[model samples]
Target: ASNAYGNSVGRLVRLAVIILFIYAGLLGLTGLGFKIVPGGFLPTQDRGYAIVFAQLPDASSLDRTQAVVDKISKIAHETPGILNTVEFAGFNLFGG
Candidate 1:
């Protein structure tokens, strides 16, 4: 009886792990199609996102920076996998 109980518990634990892995795999597969193609997952080497520090003397005026931001936003919007973007502008000194 003791051995049987231990065996059943072990089997249940293995089954639970297998079910969890299968669920995860299925959920992950749904996004597999989007992993490739333009605007999709970018490798670490990609310089696609550039963070500009506000303190730089050569930083463009707010309007010019906004123009650049808009351009990038448009590009992202037109891309297939990009869902949305949230941009925030804060006081240059305190925010960074």
Candidate 2:
């Protein structure tokens, strides 16, 4: 078995060509599989909460930010299918 394997490896040109063809075929099949599959890798799931970020200019005052946040919260509460909303002014979850 070792001798046969060695002989096959000795044919570097043929082995390289065969390997390249196999790799290309596998890649083509992967592309085809993606085209045939629907809805992508992860299906959308509804988690019960949503976050709204109201961003103002860099030099904007806290009062301005608070007013914007309040308006957004009010609008969200008026919209259907939204249970509740929580607002934070002069604070960032990602930044902090």
Candidate 3:
């Protein structure tokens, strides 16, 4: 087995030009892959969580905002297939 392995290594050494070409081709394919594939750590998916945003007219009172949030939370809790509701009154996520 050792003798056969030595002969194979000798043959490959003699084919250095072919080996270099194959290596270059593989590297080209890798660069092409980077261009073809989408770049993201994780693919976008529906994780079953939903965000509800509520907006009121300008100059609305904090109490009014809380009331609207509480009403939305209550309705969400009473609805079927909704596991839970989180209320964030007077907070505008997109406004920041």
- What's the CA RMSD of model 1 in angstroms? 12.3
Supply candidate 3's per-residue lDDT for 96.
50
* lDDT per residue (tens digit) for residues 1-96 in model 3: 999999999898879978899999999999999998877655566466879988899989999999999999999899898998778988989875
Candidate 3 TM-score to native: 0.51
lDDT of each: 0.68, 0.87, 0.88
Misplaced by over 4 Å in model 2 are 1-45
Better of 1 and 3 by TM-score: 3
Model 1 regions lying over 4 Å from their true place: 1-59, 89-96
1 or 2, greater by TM-score: 2
lDDT of 1 by residue, 31-81 (tens): 785575455467667865644433433555777666666776777789886
lDDT-wise, the better of 2 and 3 is: 3
Per-candidate clash tally: 0, 0, 0
TM-score computed on alpha carbons, candidate 2: 0.50
Ranked by TM-score, top first: 3, 2, 1
